[model samples]
Target: MNFWQSFIGGVLPYIAVATLVLGLGYKVTCWLKAPVNLHWELFPYPQTLGGQLSELLSEVFTLRSLFHHNRRLWFPSLVMHWGIYAVVFWLFFLLVGAPVAIYLGTAGGVLALTGSCLLFLFRLFVPGLRQISTPVEYLNLLFIFLLALAALASGALSDLAFRSYFISLFAFKPHLPLPGSYLVFLLLLWLFMIYIPFTRMAHFAVKYFTYHKVKWGEVE
Candidate 1:
């Protein structure tokens, strides 16, 4: 990578993560300081705070969406999401601990690869989804495909492929004999996350906001 690519590949991701964290903090603080209670409805049901907490735990941790939908898309999406979460947790574990995941053997790698492959197939083979998929969607799928591929391949190679590919880029040595399959995938994944917040893909978040605005389950 050149100077700009180095900045983008190395510095931009951290910057984006920082911006996301700080922006979220600022928004929360502003919301707290405001006099108005913005979420008065509690929408579908008026629950006590404890009930809401229990609902949230059930929804997010247990992934209520997948169980509710129980479709091909949901299965792959759930797996890919969990795989990403696992990888992120592992990375944080490495940073704070003694890099214990390196010895996690093939189980972690296999799970990540299978989840990613499922996600890739979901995007590729599902006609209803594929018809509406954009370049960004395809690119995001490609990123996961490569990331999973790299993880699986790295297990068999003696080249320290995952570490060298990223760490080398960080050290300003983009010309290392490292496979860029993972790096490109990661970069594109971050880009997709950044873009999604500003795109129609935000419907994922927006849907919850307006969930009870219209009582669709009942007709007048």
Candidate 2:
């Protein structure tokens, strides 16, 4: 394989994953270890650990409150959120060399692209959202949309050769598969990993702080 291919497909995945794990690990550890302070909020304060867990689960799986308060953005946001989950799970199974993941991942790529497009558009025309939208926020969404698009194209054009390359890497027999159509997609995937910790996407990690710590931990 060429230098760029070898680096992007092999070396950078490790780097990206390491940064994500360590960065978020440090962030969460700090959140938990730090002293708690009182902050006021208006709704649904959990009185017990179970209540906390239930609320967290709802936000993780369904993002329930967004539906009630921001119905216009809710549809695309929820769809894109699930799409991200499926795509991540699909990628995991691909690395594990699972055949079923190929089909599921392809479907996820399509769903992600669809929702990403809607979110991108909504960011433009949704007046309230548009007012607060930052360039970095749009950049993150654009990158996600591009990554999804790349996955869809590579899967269609190269017959899961990209997955095979990754599986090969994990299997200790790294080889660049033919057609090279997935190279850009793989590159974007690594960039996504690297960028995850710094973006609104890292809300996955930060939500823990928000719900259990800042908003509610003051009571504990």
- Superpose all Cα atoms of candidate 2 onto the true structure and report the RMSD in Å to 1 decimal: 2.8
Q: 93-180 in candidate 1: lDDT tens per residue? A: 4444434545432344455567667766766787876776677766656656665565556452222335544455456554333235
- True-structure lDDT of candidate 1: 0.52
- Candidate 1 stretches with Cα past 4 Å from truth are 1-10, 18-46, 98-100, 103-112, 128-135, 151-220
The alpha-carbon lDDT assigned to residue 213 of candidate 2 equals 74
Winning model by TM-score = 2
Return the TM-score for candidate 2, rounded to 2 decimals.
0.84
Residue 76, model 1: lDDT of: 63
lDDT of 2 at 100: 73
* Residue 169 Cα positional deviation in candidate 1, in Å, after optimal superposition: 13
